[model samples]
Target chain A: MRGPDAHGRFGPFGGRYVPETLMNALIDLEQAFRQCIDDQSFQEDLHTLLEEYAGRPTSLHEASRLSDALGGARIWLKREDLLHTGAHKINNALGQGLLARRMGKRAIIAETGAGQHGVASATVAALLGLTCHVYMGEEDMRRQQLNVFRMQLLGAHVVPVTSGTRTLKDAGNEALRQWVAQVEHTAYMLGSAVGPHPYPMIVRAFQRIIGKETRQQFLARCNTLPDVLVACVGGGSNAIGFFDAFVDDASVQLIGVEAAGSGLDTDAHAATVSKGTPGVFQGSLSLVLQDRHGQVLPAHSISAGLDYPGIGPEHAYLHHINRAQYVAVTDDEAMHAVEVLARHEGIIAALETAHAVAYVLKCAPRMPRDAHIVLCVSGRGDKDVSTMMAYKEAHA
Target chain B: MNALHTTFAALRKQGTVACIPFVTVGDPDLEVTRALLPALAAAGAHVIELGVPYSDPLADGPVIQRATARALAHGTTIGDVLQLAQDTRIDGLDVPLVLFSYINPIMQYGINALIADAARSGISGLIVPDLPYEEAQDVRATARDHGIALIPLVAPTSHARIASIVAHADGFVYCVSSLGVTGERASFASEGFALIETVASLTDVPVCVGFGISAPEHVAQFSRCCDGIIVGSALVRTIEQHSEALLDRSRRVQATRDVAHFLRTLFSQSSGGAQ
Candidate 1:
């Protein structure tokens, strides 16, 4: 298993691009992660928390009716949507919450996009009796108000960030800024497979269980690996979690679907891997949407979760090496996929996850009958009801 | 010594603190930025930091973020900011000027091109808030080739790594006053002083204290500990609040005067060089 090299380079992406104030914190976190990865007690504790607290070993569901409607490849869903807090974010949150406790940190600071990560972080912090503070963009606060209230109900302080774009990126800026002041006692529970070195590495490791389960469950049922693996990409935590387990299997083609708000041909989209160039943003060197002079361009997407200008560095590396193929699904297509799943398979996915579903809906119809595909249902659409209502109202 | 080293050395010889002021370029307007550079230099700023506006500035606090937004609102590109630096040079601005940009903007400008242009613009040094040692190797090489100083910043958390960061790194070391972005603070920890003192003791390169440097007392205190102090958010806030009414008119000289007077008062106390 070729892990990130000592310097934390994942094929020209992922490095410690951070303020010096947090540099040592990252090193400390990385050391803690490495130590705990091998400690039997730590492993058992995390495993127990995943099972007993976050309700892990999320089921792998065969969307038989939906697959039959598509009329081609057999489609399956890795039900992270069924995880506690209704998203895969809980997996990493619980793991990092444990790491923070191990490091003796009493406070956990996190940034949230769609509020799912915030709720997950707050859930773990509440469960462990740690002081929790989540920074969420003002724009996101409006888009995902329920999640904000959920975070607050969990006894976490939700700070509304009104900085640039007032979205995920801005929320991160505020979180990092606040972290600088309290690095002594706080652990930044970064919510995605992004940010500086050990964060992407750490988040990806915690999320690996998603794919690990999918692979095992698929093997138990279908007797072989799926021919194609699909997941949505934002900061790409859930995708990387699912993709990492299947990365080495050459026969399994990894597909990452990006949020295309309107269309990739237009400016309004978060198709970072498709449209972005290599640059440093937030923390890591990765594919980011930037103008000619290098100022980061705010990404727009109907789904707040996927509305970010940069993708995870590992995903960038994956796209660069042709290990994973990235495609864009417009808001209309994704919404349609949501409706299709809700009607046929009794699954209502987050708008972010619907992008992957949209892609499978289009592609499955043309694939061979026996072909199998595992799609990551990253989160439940309960948090996205407002967005769905607005779309319906606008269209009606 | 490079221009940064030479500037710090001269300040050290004078036994005075180098009062460095930072302002976002093209905030309100570039014409004002062009004028403010020399005004700040004449007003006791030993070195000037011209902030390049970026969409996302993680290392900054609210004041600088607003300043950046104002500058970016005016569509001030890095190239435009560099042109203003060149204009200041033509205006015979004598103080050492540095470009303070986030890595994304510099990467977009192309690292080598940005370095070459900075050298052309008579820029003395570069401070990338996000570019620490582990990831700065690429731009650091080109900056070295251009004789441009790549100022290294060491935070208090960077305890054991300080010696190595200061050893191979060029330019004066920036000692972050406390854990946080740039903003005024009531007081800093004693550990901050100890960190700066340790960094100062380790190398020939000068150590400068920055972040939360708002008060003149901070200048006097940090002056005793290191080679200099950086005054950013306070100066930026003054310009942002005062320059709004005078933006379209040259009467905005009030903002410049406000900045100059603020620095004058701050440094006048620091001339005693700490208690």
Candidate 2:
């Protein structure tokens, strides 16, 4: 309902906090985006690609059996898992890919934590015939090897980042560093609704299709907006995408679930909003996992995608303004929910999405039977098979 | 005048280009940093840049990143780095100390508090590599109030941005010669030389170039282009090769000698006044 002001600020949050070298580049991007974003031809071309190539308008299904098992709120699943590249990451990747071609950049660069974003970027790069390079943490690359191979097959040079925490944060840092040097000829295809100004706004605009579609589809199916919108928050793109259209609906509640890797009581967690302080990081002002001296702490999660130490600035703004309520779900809780969804709903959600399912399991029982909840299934759990196997092996 | 201004003014009068060396504080340990600062200063570092180790140094390359990791591994905080600078000052090291960091640590420390503590710690100025001048007004004002110069960075920039940076530049303007992040490179771009020229033409303050000047020849070549030269990753890489053990006092001593010798070599080869 409400967008960031002219400064790309959602209140005191988003701004282009970067090196002087990248300031002009960011300005150029902002100007380019501002000009072409509303142009009919640009939107048409982007829409055509989204529909023809990337598979837009993913289905909305009612999880009746899972709803029956939960025995309370009716559950509607917005299947972003069906998007090309098996995750909603392609939405932004494709959008940025088109923008990159429009800007006449020769190559595309991106940072990946879950590997989904990298895969999506690579997929788009291959489709559009742009050379792509992706920076992924060594740990994430090892765990998400399937996606890595997929990226390699798609002709992207995946650079393994071994610096910092060796996760999303480090990959992001490496990408930004690479972008600083190659700004004239490369487009940094940022994956999430995080980072500096314009990026958060641009990503949200591309992803807002989820909310826009959900509104139309749900109205046709259920005849009304759901009582609640629930989505996992790892840099908060899917949640922002899901929440943006319904943000003005006072009756609709937006719930963002953070990944609690072990538990919030322990050090191993990515529950940034729950445990972090406000600081400037990764080109934006957001709630970050940092120590007393503001050195960003490494975040952990079972899902590589949800292991980022920082959330998007708009999510922080929303949390600050009480527009949304944030909750933390432990890895164990999420895994159990993943199993429950598999057994009851015949759906295996990505561990990142399982966090929301886990939260719904906890909250649904308390809600009225008539109350409706829509869980944004941001991605399918195909990539998490190895993690599942490891969990199985360890527990066995 | 402040220590930074005084140092630059005196260096100008001496017709000598400043040899500024950067090292991550608490890189090996606080003791190593303490001894290293003075050694670098004594070896002809006109101004010493002490890096505040950040987990995510976006502008930094592998060399500095490894140094920061080593520093953080030993639980080195900004407070500890400030303590080291203060201790070195107490031990009669008179080099103008510039605390170089990303903005997060200073923001966490509270900008006003950091400026006050920096001044008390005998720190002369600050250089946040990622902090552009547009978002730096408040910190610059407070730093000025605290007698600490908030040094503005001039990357390889366009003419308009260069004008904006020079018009408001305090202390000395740090001109990054390389197109990329901090590291030693084999060669320089013609644009880098042009950037130094552009900055020098517009600014009264000393213009120092950093981001990839390693060898003594590089120092001599760059010294001819600007008022000063900052050696970062190459200098850190030198100590890293000798003192891998971080806590080994003898190894640290050897590394400190190597750095001092490195700076001495660079300065001895430097011919004269800024080009």
List model 2 lDDT by residue over A11-69, tens digit each.
88887678888888887888888877888888998899889887889999999998888
| Model 2 bad stretches (over 4 Å) | B244-247, B250-254, B273-275
Q: Please, what are the lDDT tens digits per residue for candidate 1 over residues A258-366?
A: 9988998999999998999999888888999888888888899999999999999999999888999999999999999999999999999999999999999999999
Compute the lDDT of residue A138 as modeled in candidate 1.
96
**How close is chain A of candidate 2 to the true chain A, as a TM-score?**
0.99
How would you encode candidate 1's per-residue C-alpha lDDT over B44-98 as one tens digit per residue? Answer: 8888999999888889888988888989997999999889988987999888888
Residues B58-148, candidate 2: write the lDDT tens digits: 8988999999999999888888888888899788999899999899999999998988999999899899987887778888999989989
What is candidate 2's local distance difference test score? 0.89
| Candidates in order, interface RMSD in Å | 0.9, 1.1
Q: Each model's DockQ? A: 0.85, 0.75
lDDT of residue A290 for candidate 2: 92
lDDT for B207 (candidate 1):
83
Q: Please name the candidate that would achieve the greatest lDDT relative to the true structure.
A: 1
lDDT of 2 at A36: 76
Candidate 1 collision pairs = A180-B179
Candidate models: Cα lDDT each: 0.89, 0.89
